[model samples]
Target: MNGTRLRPATFKYIESELYAYPDYQREINKIRDEIINGQEEQDENIGAGKNSYRKPGRPTERTVTRLDDNKRMNHLKEMVHVVEQVYDRLDDTQKKMIQLRYWSKRGANWEYIAEECFISRRTAFNYRKEIVGAIASKLGMN
Candidate 1:
């Protein structure tokens, strides 16, 4: 039995997506229209031969692989969107800290984050933890 648990009653699906706001609406459109629209176009006949690549007579292993890839991509895109939403929700400093600590190519060290945030390394580390925890909670992974 673990004492550390996320707070209760955080589900808010019906609410508007912060990622779909006017500022980032294009990103949402890309995900919804491109990925899902193509998914619908290809997924119409999953069991039949006419699928994915539109090959005839029993969709082959490649078609199945394509479908699986589409599904995985869709899920990954959704996860990215959710994380983007959480990123938007975080405070400005928190956002900067998170980006510096994670989104950077080499992944900035805590000292860098501390300097950027004008705080101690320990505080910077705590901010990163808090920001990441919020994202994980929003994605329903925590």
Candidate 2:
């Protein structure tokens, strides 16, 4: 395992983000629901608004442009999308290595994690470097 070429801050940020995958999905779902519900309410009130004049121009902006206009939503989607793309490229054991090393609250030592994964401790560390390097590359931080 060659040392990661990522800067220290970038490496740490990507390492921390491994723990945020679940939270990101939940937030995405919540924001998605909010957008859907808000749109539905707007649809329900469309004809009853005080402004009686129907606009002669475009009824709605393109969905892509409208989504891009939302800074928070766009930021979250970009973060999640980059990580997921990198994660999906890993093999199953590599994913398991990540789960044991980062996501496990048990704070298991490398020895224990390696034992569980049937790999050496050095291999476990190598897997971590690879994972972090992949994430950094995907984010254009490397």
Taken over the whole model, the C-alpha lDDT of each candidate is 0.55, 0.72
| TM-score of each candidate structure, all chains considered together | 0.51, 0.71
Candidate 2 residue lDDT tens string, 1-142? 1454777888788877777766777887777666555552134445666776643444244344455577777767887898778778888888777778677654668898888889999988888888788777767777
In candidate 2, stretches whose alpha carbon ends up further than 4 angstroms from where it belongs are 1-4, 39-66, 104-106
In model 2, pairs of residues that clash are: none
C-alpha root-mean-square deviation, each candidate:
10.7, 4.6
Clashing residue pairs, candidate 1?
none
Best by TM-score: 2
TM-score of 1: 0.51
Error of 2 at 59 (Å): 7.7
